[model samples]
Target: MLLEATDIHKTFQEGRETVHVLNGVTLSLARGEIVSLEGPSGSGKTTLLSIVGCILTPTSGRVVIEQHGVNAQHQGELARVRRQYIGFVFQQFNLFPALTALENIEYALNIKGVKGAAAQREAQRVLVAVGLAERLHFLPRDLSGGQKQRVAVARALAGNSPLILADEPTANLDSVTGGQVLEMFRALAKQENRGLLIVTHDPKVRAVADRVLKIEDGRLI
Candidate 1:
């Protein structure tokens, strides 16, 4: 398994009330597989992704990636894990307005300690894979919604992490563009042996998934 999340739970205290957001959610992801998580808004899908991605600590749970158990209390370790093992694509395009598409991908590679020609080459490679080679120098504002999301996807994949987690990646895209992106994810998982987990309400996403999981009221059903 590339990733395993066992018996996860999350709770938040709002004023005097305690809200339970996740309840014993468990998931397993393997290389060469794509899993789609579907649920209504506020059903804790993103929360689960956060914990699995090592971004947020769960109230109680265990997250293991590549045989190493994650310690939520260790911020540095979590950061390292996120950098080395996981790639995340948020619902909103979090691209820097100041950086061009190629530069954005190069920045992620730079953070991973890749530099100079290597980073530039890798960035160009992923841009080509996303069919954005011609638009590599364009800023986020110059790109369409689908194009921007593809850039986000390219940024995530540029690092070549074993696991990729995406939250509502196709939310703003039209059906044709969304399908293209989802197909790219499927190809990556199958051809590159990467594990892909996507949280989405789009039926198109579910259609390409190897497994479809539905979360309701904090539990997977």
Candidate 2:
């Protein structure tokens, strides 16, 4: 399994009461599979992603990535492990406005300690994989919504992480573009042997997932 999350629970402290978010959510994702979590807004979809990505500490339960359990107490170690094992795609297409498509991908690799020609090579390769070789020089403002999301996917895959966690990846695109992205994800999972866990409300995206999981009232339904 690329990712295993067992009996996960998350609680937030409100002004005078406690808000229970995730309640004993357990999930496992294996390589070459696409799993989608479908939930309504404020249904703890993003919260669950945060916990599994090791960005937030679960109030209870354990998260293991490639068999290594995340230690919530050690913030630095958690950060390192998350960087080593997981890549993220977000709904907002969080690209740097100042950087071109290639530059944005290269920037991610650069921070991961890949530099110079190696970084450029990998960035180019990833963009090509996402069918964006011709858009390498286009800045975020110059690209269409679908193209921007493709860049985001390229960025996520640039790290060569075994697991990709995407939150509403196709939320911003039209149905046709969104379908294209979903198909691309299917190909990537098979070709690269990567595991994908996506959180989305779109039925079209859910239709493409190998497994669809629904959550409501902080519990998997």
Candidate 3:
């Protein structure tokens, strides 16, 4: 399995009342499969993604990646592992405004200690792969929403991580553009053999997923 969560639970205490975000949530995703976490606002979809990505520690239970449990790793070690193993795409493009498309993707490689001529070559290839070869020199403001999203995809693809965690990836695009992005994801999963977990409420995206899961009131529905 690429990602696994075993009875994961988390809660927050607010004065006299406690807010439980995830209640015994358990799921597993295999390689080359696209799983959509379908839910409404306040359904804990983002909460679950954070927990799976190791951004937040669960209050109870455990998360396992590649069959290894998360509870045993130290904070710093776990974070490093997360960075090396997972990629993320958010609703917003989140690109650095000043950086060109090529520079944006290169930054991710630089963080992993890949730099100089080699970094540029890798970034160039990724940008081309994402259909932005001509727009490599363009800044964020110069690109459209769909182009920005493609750049984000290139950045995520640059790392070649085993698991991709995307929160509302289609929220910012028109339906046609969103469909194109979804198709790109599907091609990546099939051709690259990675796992993609997207948290979204769009019914159109539901059909693209290999499996559809709904969460309501902090539990699987």
Candidate 4:
């Protein structure tokens, strides 16, 4: 297994009231496989993905990335492990307006302190893999919805992270375009041999996953 979360629990307090979110959730993923988390609105699917991505720490649970053997690491160390091994994509394009598509990918490498001409070269290679090489110079405002999504995917791939977490990645695209994006994700999972977990309500995506998990009322059913 690449990821393992055992008996995860989380809660949030808003003012004097405590809101329950995830309750004893456990999940795992293996290499070179695609998993889809399916849920309706108000389900805890997003919350679960957030925890898995290390975007939100669990109130109580164990999260272990088996490859890095990080179960015993501290909070800061766990975060660094996540940064070096995980890539995240969201429903929104989340592209920087001022930066071109190629530049945006390079910025991700820059965050990891990878610099110079080599970073740009690798960024271009990733963009080409995602079928966005011709539009490398375009800004987010000038690209179509599918093209923008490809750019977002390129950014995620630039790091060469072993795990990719996508939250409603194709929610904004038309059915035809969404299918293309789904195909791209499948290719990434197979060609890159990475673990790809997507949290979405889209039926089209569910069809593409190796396994589909249903979530309801904060529980995986």
Candidate 5:
């Protein structure tokens, strides 16, 4: 398994009230597989993704990436795990307005300790993989919504992380564009042998997934 999240739970204290977000959610993903997590808004989809991606620690249970247990007690360890094993894609194409498509991916590679000519080469490779070779010089604002999201996908592929976590990746896209992105995701999972866990409400996403898991009121039902 590339990613394993077992019996995870999360709670937040807001003043005098306690909010339970996730309740004993357990799931696993293997290489060359795509899993779609579908649920309504505030159904703990993002929370679960965050915990699985090593960005947020669960109140209980364990998250293991490539058989290594997540050590959420240490911030440094969490950051290292995320950088080495996971990549994230967000709803809003989280690209820097000042950076071109290629530069954006290069910046992600830079975070992974790749630099200079090496970073440029790797960035180009991923962008081309996403069919953005010609648009590499276009800034985020200059690109269409689908193009921006493609850039985000390329950015996630920059470090060649074994696991990819996305939250509502196609929310801003039209039906046709969303379908294209989903196809790209499927191809990446099979061709690159990467595990993808996508959090989305779009039914189209479920059509391309190997398995569809639904969450309701913090529990998978």
Candidate 6:
């Protein structure tokens, strides 16, 4: 399994009350598989994605990636796991406005400790993979919504992470562009053998996934 999350639960203390987000949610993703997580608003979709992406520590339960059990309490270890095993894509492109498409990917690789000429090569390779080769030097401002999202995808793929976690990746694009992006995701999982867990509310996205899982009231159903 590329990713396995078992009995995941998250609770937040809000003043005097406790807000229970995820309750014993269990799921797994295998290599070359695309899983879509669907849920309503405030149904803990993003919260679960955050925990799986290693940005937030779960209140309980375990997350294992590539056979290594993650130590959520160890910040350093969490960072290492995130850098070495997981890539994240968000609803917003989240590209630096001043950076070109290639530069944006290069920056992501730099965070993974890849820099200089090696970073440049990997950045170019992934941009081409996402069909953004012609827009390599275009700044975010110069690119369309789909192009910017493609750059974000390339950034996520730059380090060759085994698992990709995407939260509402197509939320900001039109139907045509969203379909194109979904196809690219399918190619990445099917051809590149990357595991993808996409959190989305769109039925079209669920239709494209190899398996569609729904969450309600913090539990997977």
State residue 65's C-alpha deviation in candidate 3, in Å. Answer: 1.4
Clashing pairs in 6: none
Clash number for every model? 0, 0, 0, 0, 0, 0
Worst 10 residues of 1 by lDDT: 184-193
Q: Residues 21-115, candidate 1, lDDT per residue (tens digit)?
A: 99999999998889999999999999999999999999998999999999899999999998899888878979989999999999998987789
Each model's TM-score, in the order given?
Answer: 0.98, 0.97, 0.95, 0.94, 0.98, 0.98
- lDDT of residue 101 for candidate 5: 97
Cα error of candidate 5 at position 174, Å: 0.6
lDDT of 3 at 128: 91
lDDT of 4 at 64: 73
TM-score of 5: 0.98
Query: What lDDT score belongs to each candidate, Candidate 1 first?
Result: 0.91, 0.91, 0.87, 0.85, 0.92, 0.92
Q: Candidate 1 clash total?
A: 0
Model 3: per-residue Cα lDDT over 64-142, one tens digit each: 8877678634788577757677778889989999999999989988886679998899899878988999999999999
Q: What is the lDDT of residue 178 in candidate 2?
A: 94
- What digit string (tens of lDDT, one per residue) describes model 6 on residues 91-201? 998999999999999998999999999999999999999998899999999999999899998888888998998989999999999999999878876787899999998
> How displaced is residue 220 in candidate 2, in Å?
0.8
lDDT of 4 at 178: 90
lDDT of 5 by residue, 103-206 (tens): 99999889888899999999999899988989999999999999999999988888889998888999999999999988987897688888999999899998
What lDDT does model 2 reach? 0.91
User: Where is the poorest 10-residue window by lDDT in model 4?
Assistant: 65-74
| Candidate 3 deviant stretches above 4 angstroms | none
| RMSD of candidates 1 onward, in order | 0.9, 0.9, 1.5, 1.7, 0.8, 0.8
- In model 4, the clashing pairs are none
Candidate 5 ranges beyond 4 A from true positions: none
